[model samples]
Target: MKLLFIALAFIGVAVRFAVFVSPIHEFASQRVEFSVPTNSWRRVSEGLFLYGIGVDPYLGDTFHETPFCLGLLSKLHRVNPLIIDILFPVADILAAILLYLFAQNFLEQKVVEEHKVKTSFKKESQILMLSFDCIRTVPKLVVLCYLCNPLTVGSCWAKTTTVFTNLLMAAMLLSASQGACRFYRYISLVFLALCTYQTFYYGLLFPALHLYFENFAGSKTHCRSRGDSVFGLLMDGLVFIGSFAIMLVVSSHIMGSWTFLRGVYGFLISAPDLTPNIGLYWYFFTEMFEQFRSFFIWVFLINICIYSIPVSVKLRHHPMFALFTLLPLITAFKPYPSYGDIGLYLSLFAVWRHLIPQMRQTLIVSVMLVLAATVFPVLWKLWLEVGSANANFIYAITLVLATSQVFFVTDVMLAHEKREWHLKHGVETVDKTGKRLELHLQ
Candidate 1:
């Protein structure tokens, strides 16, 4: 097990290193110029030295950048898109480590607290709980889903989705999952707050996720005092407010008006009806839907099937599941979705692990995955014809299907019983006369 863990760690590091050193001539070589207040620090830094020339360093006519994002970027004396991009895979790996730590803590918590229940239930419920327990090792499954995902790898060169998602995931682990106390909770919120500012669409979702994890995951029930529980909630809210305010102020200052602010809010409140090309919202949803509509929904359904596992039925009362389900619908405010993003993908994987103990349930999920993978792309091609050839169409499809694949693979691991088999055989041993004999398997 140690060897396996080490090997996985090495692979994650190597992948990140490759991406970090990968040529950034294309990314840096783009001749576009200008600055958003959110990035005013870069302008200030360059201007102070009178070093950077020919790059458009103007704060454009709108609050083009979120404030904290600007402030954070401003602090950096150097702007290397290449270095920034490389940081993501490293962050992803860090998130994986955090996840492992959390899982170990969770298992330990269950053992100490004995989250165990009576084995006897109605025939159906018994099957359900067993399956749920069987999938207990699922959080580890999430680690793999995050690490080896092709879409995640591909996006390394495209953007910093991995880094932000990993930060958010760590936030979930610290704030939502059981562990060492207040420090982690605060740490989680701080990271979440900064991350939210970076991408407004993701901003609201972070708070919502913590709310879900707190209430839905086992955390809600574990609180020792109302104040402790409430503290977590308040911290997340504070981060949200602080981050959003920074974004707004910076954007307004940069743009010389509140137009972007209004537009951002407009996107949140209204859902207009128009041709895919006319309304941005309409285009976002339809294009996003059309690109990977068939596959994403199918994969989601497979997760649903995994949830139907007899064991997972007992966890129906869990707050995490509810948070996971509602989060996507709410966060996808404008209709454009990134399946490759960690938020949706990791949550779906969590659901899959929650549901994987029942063979009947698992088998059904398997079928759905196979079918979705095969059919989703074909449907996307058809949607493209209806919508006309969209230059950004492939990106949309890739994001959606990539998200589905993350969840689908997580589902597979949830249904897996390999870990249980290892435990049963007592991989631990005692040696007598240099002849090893299994302890528990004896």
Candidate 2:
């Protein structure tokens, strides 16, 4: 454990030093430039520049970050940009540590639950399950995975604000999963609210995470009455909404007006930027009929939420796995999806390493991510710069990327269902005909 923390610090400094020394500095040499997405780091810097010179950041479409982010970056005007560069790696490190703590705590809870159901688990099945020593080291394992992953390193190298959002999200997870005080759960809600304030899509997470919070906060000794649970959730919802509202108000006050409400969020909901990226949105919308764009935009946004609510309800009992499933959905469907989002979810997958063995097409999904990330720049250059290929060429790769990610989401959900079936009935999952049931991907 001591050596793991040492390695963690080393990784933090190493990423910072590498970012400083590499040409990826200032988004040059990096294919995924920050300017392409809404609320990008470069855009915030642009906003901060305007704010420093007595102009509003929301005065134009160039910046889409919340005034809170702009205000946070405004502090950078006082310090060197290199300091902010160092800060991102530090955020990554902190987030890694938080995720480690959260995973360890979650695993401990699972161990306790498993003990209560020990009789149901068969002997061989229990042998294949996580060992006590392995459980103890899960934190280090999860943290090391995050630190060593290319997606995480790439996102940190790109200097996107996602590292900060990830940090907040990780903290919320840690707080909600651990700690005993009544106030701890509310603190987690505050962080969740802040996360939604920073990124709109996280608002959908409210139901799932609140479900997690209820499960975490509920007592095993006694069943709370239905009316009490409803009242508690209602009050928590108010807190979440109230905190988010206060955050928005504070952000607006910081920017001196509500103008940012449009510039930042409007750009997010409406896909005005047709810049090529890993997502499915840019290419389709780029060629879409301009007259019907509005309808389709709503359709796409609704499409993102459509599964979230129903899935949240159906899989509400398995909050962690349900959240895990939703992640790749976000990576697939977000209007401004990026590899950074993939990294965020992949880190969660690491925390839930028990699910990996159940996932079908692991090798295919891994290959798909590598191919997608590696080929995008080359194909993009061929189509946009070299002019030998048409938009369909790169769009095909985007299709591959989206399809692979959606497949992963489904695979994980199926894996979770399989695991639950085995746990409840027995390790031997068989049909009524007495044949072993295999998890088949559709």
Candidate 3:
């Protein structure tokens, strides 16, 4: 499974490199190139080098005050932008693998802990250990979802937000799984910081979701209960203060002073005026609203349906899944489309833990349709803009199909796990009562 996963990831990387090395359209290249200094690491890399040489590469011949990651990366070596693009997908795959390992270990721990609580030295204990094996099922599914993801493949060739978002998300998951007290947590912060400049607005969502996850996971309660309020307080302070710092740094780097905050906020709240005669929020709300409505609605409904299953709902309070669903929803609501909900990809993987039988197929088809709906627009636009099918498109479709397929395969696996869990617990009889049908473990 690991080899197969790695092979698929390399295929994605190959497609990215192919596109980067090829002679593509100028406009297409412009769209795909990492040129924008604000969010483009490549550009930031160049600026860093220029700065090291005592040359100002600012927009208007002034010193820039953005985060230092790009400058640092740039100073290391002179690399092609295409190479940099390839690195994004590669990083995503590597991060995804790390996430898989962490999740697998975490789930094992959960199984043991839950088994201990639910089963004592009784006949049920035997069944509980058998059921514990089922928890091991989720990690493979999660990794495969990332490996075969269409959006991930598509992101490989372009300077899109998806790759960075996924990488940061993977970092978050890895950190969470390792326990928040580790040095990796701070390292995760550095990844979060890098993500901010990689895609600016979209990358910001990762850290935002991280905070939400920390809160949802009972970490906030644990901290507060222990009277260690400083960490949580400091974290919240950072969200507000860091956001302002981002805006201030960007303004200082580009526009000078904080005047750009208005435009930034305005753009976030409303759409940019494409035409001179066009009005404000009208274009944002009405037009783009219609465009994304079906996709957004489908995502919401499908998730709700998937969550309706008993086992699925059981995970509702799990910090990872909770943050996964909420982050995407919040980011999706912004007037500007954000890949921040790339976190949703994680939720999609997490939900595979549920063992609902009847709704399984429906959930699979629904998720595929939603993914297609979300990704097709870009696929079609790129197809039309360029002639003929390309490697990236192929990668994108394969990823979409693979991710969707995981939904099916995982549902079956989860159902099996549920049955095993029941068997171990000695829940032999199923009773339909006036209130509800309950399945007990011993």
Could you say which candidate leads in lDDT? 2
RMSD of 2: 2.4
Judging by lDDT, tell me the better candidate of 1 and 3. 3
Candidate 1 stretches greater than 4 Å from native: 20-65, 74-82, 107-116, 119-139, 178-192, 201-316, 327-334, 342-354, 358-442
- Number of clashing pairs per prediction, in order: 18, 0, 4
Against the true structure, whose TM-score is highest? Answer: 2
Residue-wise C-alpha lDDT for candidate 1, range 169-248, written one tens digit per residue: 56565454554454555565566565555544444445344544454334446644677558766776776577557756
lDDT of the candidates, in the order given: 0.44, 0.77, 0.47
Deviation of model 3 at 368, angstroms: 6.3
Please give each candidate's TM-score. Answer: 0.55, 0.93, 0.57
Ranking by lDDT: 2, 3, 1
Model 1 reaches what TM-score against the true structure?
A: 0.55
RMSD, every candidate, angstroms: 12.0, 2.4, 9.2
In candidate 3, what are the lDDT values of residues 1-442, reduced to their tens digit? 6687568656644654555566532333244212121233344455666656755455332222243433434534455544555566567667667767766766775566556555443364344342555556667667666555544544444444345556765775566566545355455555555445333443433434354345533543453443343565466446534754664586456433443343333333333322211012222234455678557545533542342233323443343444343333333333333222332354354534444442346666567747754554466456656655543563454346435544544444445445554645454534455353443321
Q: Which pairs of residues clash in candidate 3, taking residues 3 or more apart in a chain or in different chains?
A: 127-424, 148-399, 150-399, 425-442
